[model samples]
Target: MDTLMPADDLTDELRAISAVVATLEHAQQNELPDEFAGLFRHDAIWTTGGGRRLLGRDAISAFTHQVLPGAMAASTATYEVEHVVFIRPDVVAVKVRQTPVGRDGVPLPGVNPGSPTYVMAKEDGRWLLVAAQNTEVVDG
Candidate 1:
């Protein structure tokens, strides 16, 4: 068995991964389905916070385009990168915190937060989302 050691470019890799999450937040807030869809790999799988499972980039793109328009009329979301674990030199698992916010940036009322985990791979010097699962945190 071998231990997972931190690579010398860990900081740079984290920045790159975090940029992806930032782009996600921006795309969602602006209702840009195409931009959001571009983040994923062609064969990626995604399970939404509402428990909808999407397979492949085309499916994800269709779903996003279908539901993303005007979805932010009342509120949008902010995504923050919480953790990044390097699965290998070219792969990573990223944890993100999602909060629904109003136009003024305040947290929206009666809206639960979301926790999303993104698995990404470095392809051609760019990080692409491979698989992602978004879960909503409900208060008990």
Candidate 2:
């Protein structure tokens, strides 16, 4: 079956989504777990790159607080929106590319980058991540 695209301004929507994704990266770079978790919905779901599932915002906060502070101790990660598909006027699926860089600002070796999918929903004129899955890009 063919999916019908919404009639909203695609460019504007893309820009808005990109900004949200950027904030996720910024939060990680700064090691601010609360800021990172705040981007999600109250009942958001997330799967980590290590395959652990987080059920809600509170769970996400707990996990992030335990891990995020030390995550970038050796290297920082950057996230960029690679694609955005609007499933509806209020829902979007976003593909993001994440790369970890060393203190010298060089891409780290032996550590593969990640590709994460974020499903976002627009509510009360704001976009919030409703669900997300982060996967490590393994090179064979």
CA lDDT, every model vs. true structure: 0.91, 0.88
Instruction: Please give the TM-score that candidate 2 achieves against the real structure.
Output: 0.90
For model 2, residues 1-140, the per-residue Cα lDDT tens digits are 12354445666667788989989988898899999999999999999999999999999999999999878877898888887777887899999989888866788888899999999998998899999999999981
User: Per-residue error at 75 for model 2, in Å?
Assistant: 0.3
Query: How much is the lDDT of residue 22 in candidate 1?
Result: 94
User: Which stretch of 10 consecutive residues in model 1 shows the poorest summed lDDT?
Assistant: 1-10
- Where in model 2 is the C-alpha error above 4 Å? 1-8
TM-scores, each model vs. reference: 0.93, 0.90
Query: Which pairs clash in the backbone of model 1?
Result: none
* Shift of residue 114 alpha carbon in model 2, Å: 0.4
Clashes of each: 0, 0
- Looking at model 2, report the run of 10 residues with the lowest lDDT sum: 1-10
Expressed as tens digits, the lDDT of each residue in 8-33 for candidate 1 is 46767778899999999999999999
Best by lDDT: 1
51 in model 2: Cα distance from truth in Å?
A: 0.7
TM-score of 1: 0.93
